[model samples]
Target: MQACQVEQLLADYGTEIYRYCRRLAGFGPDGEDLYQQTFLRLLEADLEPDEGRSPRALLYSVATGLWRNESRKRSRRAAIARPVELDGDDPPPLAGGEEPEAEALKAAENRALAAAVERLPDKYRAAVLLAYGAELPLEEVARIEKLPKGTVKSRLHKARLLLKKEMEARGYGREEL
Candidate 1:
């Protein structure tokens, strides 16, 4: 793609792509770094999607690889480093709601849902995040995951059950979400 085209793509999709990265990377500086890296990789690859497909899907597919690679690297580092006690800092609530109390509650609920998603095993997590977080269709998610459609569907079904159970266990529910 031309420079102008690339810039346009970034302008159009950058925030959504960054949000996806943040969700995938959990919480930290690394998420922003990975977001940058995804674009860098895209530029390096200079890929054009085949006909009938949006480049948006390709952007996410690239982001997924970058996120997974970084996750693995972090896990390896954590294994080497001695464990430190967690500080239990809660992320600040999202901005803007009619009631401050309602906003705070909503933030807590979102955080809990994110944590629940984070707890999923790698395969299930990737499938669920790609299908739901990025809002990609099941067919697109299956393509990104390089899995059969049936397998992706089965995995998503299991992931949904797990997420529902996790939320309920934490005293939240689908209604709350």
Candidate 2:
């Protein structure tokens, strides 16, 4: 694709890619960096975004690869550590009129989900995120994760089981996983 095409692609899909990155990175500045990195990697690799198909899946596949490489680097740096507490008091609340309880519940759920996902093996985590978080169909998720369809199903099952266990431990008893 030409430079104009790439720019047009960005204009169309940038928000979706950024949203995916934000979710993947647990919604922090790190996520923004990762979003930019995904686009940069695409530029570096010169992979044209195919508009006929799902750009969400394409961006995610590239982002997942980029994230995996970064994870490997962090592991090599001996950076494994327990999850940290994310206190709500640290950041000011949003101006949008959201009920406190609803906001708290949502924030808690997101944090718990993030921690649970972080615990999953990378392959399973990637499958779960692409399938559930990104709302991609199984076939596309399988392709992105580079696994057979059956393998993707199994991984998703395992990920759900693990997430259920994590939620139970976090005291969300019988409330749905």
Candidate 3:
């Protein structure tokens, strides 16, 4: 891809890749680093984005590989003391008409949601992140995970049930998810 096309790809898929990496990394800065590495690998490898297929899935495949490799290296180096906290930092401001209180509430909900996702088992977590978080089709998720469609569906279904229970335990309603 050309320089301009790479920029266009970043503009389009950057946020989704960031979110996917954030959920996988369980923190922001780590996710930010992985996001950069994902794009860097793409650029260095010079793999063209196949528009006929799912760009989101392709981006996530790259992100997941980079995250897993980095995670293994980190685990070998040391254990994590605790899950990172998101309370002090606020999400970026919304456009007009959204109150500060509402934005804060939304951020809190997002944090709770992230925590729940972080608690999931690795398999179900990957399924949920690819299928829902990255908004990829179940077929694409299965392809990415190297699982059958039925297995992906089962994993996503179970992940959703667990997420709903976790959210409710966190004082959120079932419908909220």
Candidate 4:
């Protein structure tokens, strides 16, 4: 494709692409780095598509490769690193709520939910984050993860059940869970 066409494609889909990267990397400064790397790889590759080409599919394929390579690197580093503490460092509650105490409780619940997501196994975590956090279609997520569509569905269902269980155990209750 031409440069302008590529630029337009990026402009149209960039937010979703970055959000996908955030899910893949578990949402942090590291995720932002991976997001940038995904775009860099796309540009560098010029997104050359072979027979049966779909630009969106090509972009997703590149993103998946980048994420997989980074995941491998992270696994190696994780093997040597000490386990980090998981804290429910609650962000400040929104100030305008009619009930300040309720808002504070909600904020705490949000933090606990985030921590629970962080605690999930990488595969399930990826599925949850991509399906819910990034709001991607299950089919697209399956494509990105290189899994069968049904497997992606299964992973997301299992992940949600696990997350709900953990959040409920933490006293998050139905509203928060």
Candidate 4 Cα deviation (angstroms), residue 135: 2.7
Candidate with top TM-score is: 1
Model 2 Cα lDDT, one tens digit per residue, 23-45: 67657787799999988877778
lDDT (C-alpha, whole model) for all candidates: 0.80, 0.76, 0.77, 0.73
Q: Which runs of model 4 end up more than 4 angstroms from their true locations?
A: 48-61, 80-104, 174-177
Where does candidate 1 stray beyond 4 Å? 82-107, 174-177
- TM-score order of candidates, best first? 1, 2, 4, 3
Q: How do all models score by TM-score?
A: 0.80, 0.75, 0.70, 0.72
User: lDDT tens digits, residues 69-143, model 4?
Assistant: 887887888899956967655444333435457777777778777777877887887777767876678877787
What tens digits encode model 3's per-residue C-alpha lDDT throughout 1-177?
A: 466766887999877778788888867689788888888887788877576777666777888878778867876666655555477343333334644687776777787777788878878888888877777888888877878999999998999999898777765564533
Report the candidate with higher lDDT, 1 versus 2.
1
* Candidates 1 and 3 compared by TM-score, better number: 1
Worst 10 residues of 2 by lDDT: 89-98
Candidate 1 lDDT score relative to the true structure: 0.80
Best by lDDT: 1
Which window of 10 residues has the lowest lDDT sum in candidate 4?
A: 90-99
